[model samples]
Structure formats: C-alpha cells, structure tokens
Target: MKMRLEVLLVVTAVMCAAGKPLSKAAARNKLLLISFDGFRWDYDQDVDTPNLDQLAVDGVKAKYITPPMLTMTSPSHFTTITGRWVEDHEVVHNMMFNTSTNLKLPHKLTLTKSQWWDNGVLPLWITAQNQGLKTASFYFPGGAANYSGQVVNRVMVEPFNHPNANETEWRQNIDMVMRWFSEEDFHLVTLYYGEPDNVGHTKGPDHPDRKTIIQQIDRTIGYLRKAIDQHNLADSLNVIISSDHGMTTIKKRPLVDEIILNKYLNLLKLASFEILDYGGFGILTPQPGKEQEVFDALSNAPNLTVYKKNEIPESFHLAKSERLPPIVVVGDLGFNLNSRFIVYVNKGDHGFHNGEMDMKTIFRAFGPDFRRNFLSEPFDSIHIYPLMCKLLQIEPAPHNGSLTVTEEMLQLHSGGSQRAPVSVALPLLMLLTFSAL
Candidate 1:
C-alpha cells in the first residue's frame, strides 16, 4: 500500500510539472543564430531589406551592437557566442601569430584547422551539447574546434567546401537549416553568410554592388522565415541575426613598404614577424630589442595608433594574450600596412578599434519569445550570450554579460512589449544528475 502511495505521488508530481505553464525560459525551445559577415548596422537603414525590416517590426532590433575591439571576423564572432572578449577567448585577431613559438596559420586554413582556435572557453554550441541538447553550426568560427573535449553535434566547417562560394550555395545552406529543425530536432542552430561584407570588401560600402548583396541576404532571411512557417515551427523557434562586424571604406595604404618596416625591425618577414594586415590595422611581432624602433616609426605616422602588448585599451580585453604581437599598430579610418608586393586592393576593411561607429554590427531577433516592433537600446554584443541562453532554456556559462540589459527585448508573460521578471530556467538538470544514479 505504501509503495502504491509513493508511485501515486511521483505520478502526480510529474503531471503537475508537465501541466504548468512553461516558464518563459522553456517556452521557446529552439534557437537559430545567423551571422551575416561584415553586416553594418546602418546597411538596413538605407537598403531595402524587407525581411530584416519586417523582423524588426515583428520582433526586436537593436540600434547598435558594439563589437569587441579590433573588429575582425574570428574574434567578434567568437565573442558573440562565447560572451568572452578577445583577450579571454584567446582568439585575439582573425589572423593571429604567436610571438613566443613563431606559430601562425594562414587565413585560408582558419575554418579547417582546429588548432588555430580551440580556446578552453566554451562557446554556446558546446555548452548546449554538454547539456544533452543537440547543437549545430554552419561555418561559424570555433565550430571546427572542440571545447574541453566536447564539440557541437553537427558542424559544416566551410558551407560549400570553399571560401568564395556563392549564393546558390547559401540557398542550399538555408535549406539545410530548415532540415535541422524539421528532421534533426536541432535545439541550437548557427548559420553563417559571408556577404555584403564580402561584396563590400570587393566594392566599397557605398557601391551599388554592396547594396545588391545586402538585398540578396535579405531575400535569404525571408526564405528562412518562410521555411520556419512552412515547417510549422514558428511557435517554438527564435531567430537571432547579427554580424561579426561592420565594413568601412579604405582609401589609402599608409604602411605599404616592406623595406621601411625591415629597416626599423630586423627580418620582418611574413613567416615570423608580419602576423597579418587589414586596411588600417597591422599585427606584427617586433624582434627583440627592435620593439622601440617599431613602435616609434608606426606611432608617429599619420592616422595611426600604436600600442605595446600591455598598452591595449582595457575595454577591448586583449591585454593578456601572447598570441597578440608585442607591438600593435592601428591605422586611422582608411589606412593599412600592406605588403609592398600587393596592389590595387583596399576597397573596404574592418580591423579597427571598437570606438568607430562603422565598426558596429547589426543585431535583430524575431521569434515567439521576443517583443514585437521594439527597438532595443544599444548594447554590447557580449550580452547576446545570456539572451541566447534564456531563449533556449540553457544555463549560460560564466560570461561577461548581464541579462538585465536585454530582458526588455523579450515578450511579457502575456505577450506584449513589456518588462517581466527575468526568466529563471529550471532546465531538466535533474535528468542530467540522475542519469548518473
């Protein structure tokens, strides 16, 4: 009789828990984070991005999302998902060279090589997977690397197996995302599109071609939205769209001389010293005793800022890594240190300080969980990690972000654009704990 009573209590508890209105945390069970590489916040302001604009009208949009310092691809992308700065995450720049060991990988190998990233910090994909939630990433930085011996359940290292893959490839990529939800039951999905940024780099940001690419990406988003509705997954899914960083027009090459650089620092070759270059930014290691000369020559140059390893701005969180050069030089709005052998480049670039408004990227979200037609106050992109955790009902790892800043972007308990208590997630952690028992 006692055993029967015990069973009844357990069943009653189970039914009550199941019947309870899902806390907002668990209300939205699916997440899709899509990154449009080099998507400037203002691109939609001028361009006819109907789908993105529609998302803003139906969901929430941020006025600006300040990226981490040295606004480059790998670092900012990692930051958005990890909620860690370039310093803590240890992907200091898109193109990194470790001064101590003289080790660096070419930019072409970034997506394929796990060693180039694989910092110990956990990205959201890994975090979700560790919790027994299935996660997938399509061409996102750090997706190739396993964090703490755990990896995303699925990863497409390069979307089309090549860098210069075109829209037809991206359209297929979108179809694959739909499949993830309908067939695979992916709880977390990350999709990446290298556009407007790619075109903006080829043709400056003001070019009509740049606008064309932006419009194309918008159509892609519309396709994604339509796919979700077609799959009947709208009530359970949230789509968070953002960019790694924005683009800026580059007009001049300030440090295009190998001879002059070599004169100041010995053996400044691409193999050891020249880490990498983007217009208005250079990451290079100075040979021992030549650090002074390298700093002096580049610091005084017109429209450039030079900093030693310890002197980087505190807000950037890049001061502690040995992966950074002993000397970092940043060119003003449109300048870069390029290889003298290179020519006819610098249409657009993005490796600039975060202070530059153009360096900021776009952030928009739409789903069952987000407030409608809301324009959120500007916030740092780092805050995105916590918001993602809330929407997906996962516990966020230790991160440098505050949910309070973005909680207003979520729908009220009754589904209005109003504030509610932060969603406290009591995920099926008991299942995780009891499986061991």
Candidate 2:
C-alpha cells in the first residue's frame, strides 16, 4: 500500500508539473524574428525610443545577449539562427576564402556562394520547413543558401552595394513580410536590417549620425507594431527583435595602439594564406612545416592574442572546425589586425572577443505568447533557437540552445515552465521503486 501510494503521488506531481497540453490555438501561433545589425545593448539609453520602450511594457526585454566569438556580421547572425558556435557552423568569416587557391570573395558576393554556407548543420529555416512548417527569410545571413538541396520557401538576398539606410525600402520590406504572414501563411519569418551598424562603421559608434539611425530604427518599430494590429493578426503573431553584435570605436593608427601583423611577422614567407585587414580577428594557414615558427612570431605581438588551432582557449568554442587554419589571431578591443598597411577606412568595427561589453547586443519580444512587462537578465544568444522552436510549436534540430534559459519569458499557456511529461516521470518512478524495496 505504501509503495502504491508513493507511485500515485509521483504520477500526480509529474502530470501537474508538465501543466496542460498546449492547445491547438497556441500551436498555431506564428513567429517573426527580426535582426537589426549592430544594435548595441545600450543603444537606446541615450536616445528616446518610445516604440521600443512601449514594447518593453507590452512584452519582454532582455538586459543584453552575448553573441558567439568573432563577432562579425555573418558568424554572429548564423550562431543566433543555428544555436551553434562559430566553429561549429563553419561560417567563420564574412568574406569567403579558399585556403588552397588563395581566392577570396567579399561579404556581398559570399552571400550567393552556396558552398560557403551549406555545411553539415541545418539552420532554423531549413529545420522548420523539414518539419512541415513554411518559413521565409529577408536579407538575413545564411537565408539564401541551399542547405544540402533544401532551401527556404521564400528569400530576398541583398543586391550588390545595396543601400542600407533607405527608410522607404525598410518599410516596404516590412510590408512584404506582413504579406508572407497573412497571405502566404508562413509559420516563421526572419527579417534583417542593416542599420546603425553601417553608420557606425563609417562615422564611428559615438558619432551623431548613429543617433539619427537609432531614431530611424525606433520609427520603424512603431510602424511594425501598427502594421501588425492593422492586419488584425496581432493575437496570432509573436515578434522578437534582436541584433547580431555591438560596435566599438576602432583605435586607428597614429593615435592609439594597432595590430599590424605584417609589421610583426613576415606573411609572405611564413604563411601560405592569411585573412587580415578585416576587423579584430584574423586567421593564418602556415606554410607546410612552419606552424610552430609562425606561432612563435605572432604569440608575443602587442594588442593581439595568438593561438595555435588546438591551443585556442576553450571559452571561445572555436577550435573544432577544419575551416580554421593553424594559427588564430584576435585583436584587442578597439583594434583591427592589418596585413600590409592600415587601410580599414572605417572608424568603428566589431569582431572582438565575445566577452567584451561592447560586443553585447539587444533582445526584445512581444505578442500574446510572451510575459507582459517582463525584463530578463542577460543571457547567451545561442538559447534563441530553442525559444523560437517553442514559439513555432515544432521539434527543434540538434542545437546548443536550452529552452529553460528562455522559457520563463513565455506565458503560462504558451508552453512556459513545462518539461516533457515522460522525462519528468521516469526519474520519479525509479525513485519510488527503490524506496519501496
């Protein structure tokens, strides 16, 4: 009798803890994931962001999110979507380069290169579509690639030298996304905005023009919310606004310290291929038999931390990929590693170590599914993938995200604070049996 009673109590607790099964209506909820590139965690601290503040009042806002290492545009964005570290996804740099041929393609051209993005792991768009849900991506990195013969149902890649600051085009893009939700009935849509990041790169993060871009982003958010209501689909839509990484003012030459790699090491003789003149990160493929020779030369260089592929700190989670060369270089915050000369031409840059405060970015969510007026503490951006899968009511691919890290932000009826019933039940049943014996 005692054993039976204990088992009964355990079953009751398990069922109660799992909560009610998600309702069909709840499962039908749609999701919109938006990325505003380079939107810092504190971008709105100085500027008045009425719409964004209103969003915080309506739903949820995280204090900040730490992106994966090498906080450049493509790698960080891919990490958010795939919940994988930079090395896992293997989209290690904005520019696509071949280590053997010494061929390189700029960021824009790299977008159309399927071979560059179609690695073994699947991004969320392909994962969602595989689970019988329709998905689309607009100007989002990794969106246009054919992931092992599967492709997103809808995609809009940015054209060459596309103007990033056109307000009208931004609005039009929003309008089109609304159509994807309402007319085409997409279950998930990811939209990208190239903003203050563009302005920050050219004029610096602290420049007055960056404030203007923030205002534009604020206005666009207002437009997005009003459009959601106008479409009469507000109750069925869940929206999350976030960014890839933050920006920092680059320490230019003749003023502060810089990492001119060629000045410290002989690239021509020591390296077979080198990726430099980018931002605060670089990669080197040493000439055969010269691995230790190259590492010794760069290890003591100022304003840079050099690591052999195997010696890269475990905190970075960057040593697992074949795409990575033998030696890796990370410039200190506010510095860019240069190859031949200091020719970055930009006043601000990213791609610093992920732990830097300047590399943290923004996260906001609103809709019927989220908690009202909730402010969450900082969390890693990799957890976003599981949160999105929960919102779409689909099984997620194998990912690094944990739903527990983000599930608290969801409303009770929207699958918050619930574990799979069987997962919770098994342990309790075993405990009861052992105690009875």
Candidate 3:
C-alpha cells in the first residue's frame, strides 16, 4: 500500500507541474495602456486619421469619458490608472507645492519625487508586479515613483526637455513596448506620448498647427498597430488608447476679462500662501485670523466661484485632503485665474472643472477580449481601473471603480463562457492524473 501511494503521489506532482503551464497560458491577455498626453476627444474628427478610424472599427470606442475634476496632467493621469479622485490619490496638481515652506517643484522635477506619488495608493503597475506579473511604464505620469518601496518591473522616465513632437522617437517607443510585451514577457505596459498636448498649449486648440500635430499622432497610431503585428502580438495583446484631459483655447484677449484675484481680494494681507495663476484652479491658506474675511472677498469675485475647503461640492471631488487649502477658487470656462496681468503665452489650457465639455477626453480599447465595433456611452474615467483589473484577471486593490460599469465592453465567448475557472480545471486535471496512474 505504501509503494502504490508513493507512485500515485509522484504522478499527481508531475500532472500538477504540467498543468501549471497551461493554466498560466490561459490566465489573461497582455495589456498595453497608452496615453497620448492632451489628445482631445474630438481631435481625430478634424484630422485625417485612417488608423484611428480603423481602431474604432476594430474595437470599442467611448463617446467621450469625463475626467476627474481639476483636469491637470498629474492629477488626471493618476486618476486614470488608480481609479481614484485627485483628492483621494493626493496628486492634486501638476506642480507639487508645500504650503508650510511655500516650496514648489515644477512638473518635470516632481516626476522623480516618490513622496509626491507613493502616498498609500497602488498604481496598476506596482499592483501587477506584486501579483507576479511583469509590468512597465514608459514615460507615463506617476510611472517613475516608487509605491511603498515597490516599483514596476521596468521603468523609463522621460528626460527633461524631451521633444514631444519627434515622430521617430515615437516609433522607437512603440518598438520598445513591443519588445517589453513579446520578448521580456511584460503582462502590462503603460506608454505615454507628449504630443498634441504640447502643440495645443503652444498653439490654440483651433489653430492649424494643433491639427497638424493631431495628424502626426494618428500616423503614430498606425505605426503602433503595425509594430504590434510585426512583433506577433496582434492576437494576444490588448491595447487601450486614451488621454488625460482635453484642451481649451485660453481666453487671453481683453485683459479686463481675465479672472485676476488681486482685483478682488488683498492676497498679501489675507493669505499666508497661495497657488494662483494655474489655469482655472487656485487654492490659498488664509492668514491666521482672516479666514472669514478672505472667504467673503473672493466669494463676490466676478466669473470666479469660491468655496471653503469643506464646503466644496461633492461632484468636484476636490475636498477631504490635507493637501487642499482652506479656500478654493475656480474660474469660468476658458478663463485663467491670474494673480496679475502678464503676457500669457500659452494659447490653450486645461485644468478646468471636469463638467466643461472641453475637459472631457478620449478612450479606445482593442484586443482579443474586447467586443468589436462597439460605441460605448460616456462613462467616468475612474471605471477604467476595474476594467483593466478584470482584463488582467487580477484582484484590484480598494479602488473607486466598479467592473460592472465596463464589463459589457468585453466579448463573451461561445456558450457565454470567457475564461475557464482554475478551480474547475485543476480538479479535472487531478482526476486525469489519478485515472492514468
């Protein structure tokens, strides 16, 4: 009896070892999450985008997804991947500012500061790595930071002053991501491009130059899909093309029309620190005893809405963080909240209230798992995190998204079956092993 039991145990071990390879093969499809920074939802509408049109025909396209409030780059991008509101993730702005020291870091320098990004929430890259899947982030916002001392399997931070309009460099990035998926076995990779956003800021969103950049981006999409085919990832890899937020033409003419804060309140006397002149958003810490006075002054400012931090509306999701100031100010659409009148160069800007139509962004998904030719109704950008988690077959950390919101975008296989459950497969495999022995 001992000899027979030993032989049966050996057979079971062999069967289990053989079955693992098959189980892993069937586990989940690889994901490529690409963010074209500042690519507006309707950008392709005016440009000749054969590739983008093809992508929409081949997979699912959202009407236009609403990004989280305070539609700045760092805040919006973090929300896209982590599925948390800007206040919830604590990456409340592109520039990291400390109210105590009045210290501020520019967007580039802030990219490397782990403390600015690692605050408790786990981004998709780190979460995937912890679950034994290889992941990478190539120039994606919040990609370079270490989350709780854990980093992505591979990371490439965009160098300072990196040219966003270099077409060749964009192709090279696509090739590298292909290698990450095909050669290095990366299960998920987040790639970013600083294109149309840069152009939109320099030239107005309606300018012909911005349209040209959109054309360039469309061509890059063609190159990306071709590279996927060349690398033999066409069948297995899932691709999501998306952006952080849309751009709007900045209202620069008629200086009187600008929302100048100094014109309304005495900043020096009433505020100890302030983050003003940042698009449509402003936050300030009141002087020790000037809280009510400061609030009343800005409350009556024209074209600007003032809110006490706790009194901020629930819809904006801008409250409930220590990083937030006691007083919050927002300008009307296309209006810049200026501290003083200066030569405002950028013809375009974002960081407005998300409810503005100009603040909505794009989302596209294509792969073996996604349904074909589906035009999905607009959904919140936060819902994307759960969709990605479901695609990777991984348990998502406590996120604010619900899979039910995005599950319909996926394809249901024959007999309504999608992936085979491991529990069912393992038992059947064990029975086969026992029968063979």
Please tell me which predicted candidate would have the highest lDDT against the true structure: 2
lDDT of each: 0.76, 0.88, 0.85
Q: Model 2: how far is 179 from its true place, Å?
A: 1.2
Query: Positional deviation of 322 in candidate 2, in angstroms?
Result: 0.9
The candidates, ranked best first by lDDT, are: 2, 3, 1
For residues 137-223, what per-residue lDDT tens digits would candidate 2 score against the true structure?
A: 899999999988999999899898899999999899999899889988999999999897999899999999999999999999999
lDDT of 3 by residue, 234-253 (tens): 88899998998999988866
Give the TM-score of each candidate: 0.84, 0.90, 0.89
Clashing residue pairs, candidate 3? none
**Cα lDDT of model 1 by residue, 147-252, tens digit:** 6667778988874346543777777888888888879899999988778777878888999988888888888888888888888888988889999888888765
Query: In model 1, which regions exceed 4 Å deviation?
Result: 1-28, 100-103, 159-165, 253-272, 339-344, 413-437
lDDT of 2 at 56: 93
Q: Cα deviation in Å at residue 372, candidate 1?
A: 0.2
Q: What TM-score does candidate 1 reach?
A: 0.84
Candidate 2: misplaced stretches above 4 Å?
Answer: 1-20, 23-27, 413-437
- What's the CA error at residue 266 for candidate 3, in Å? 1.3
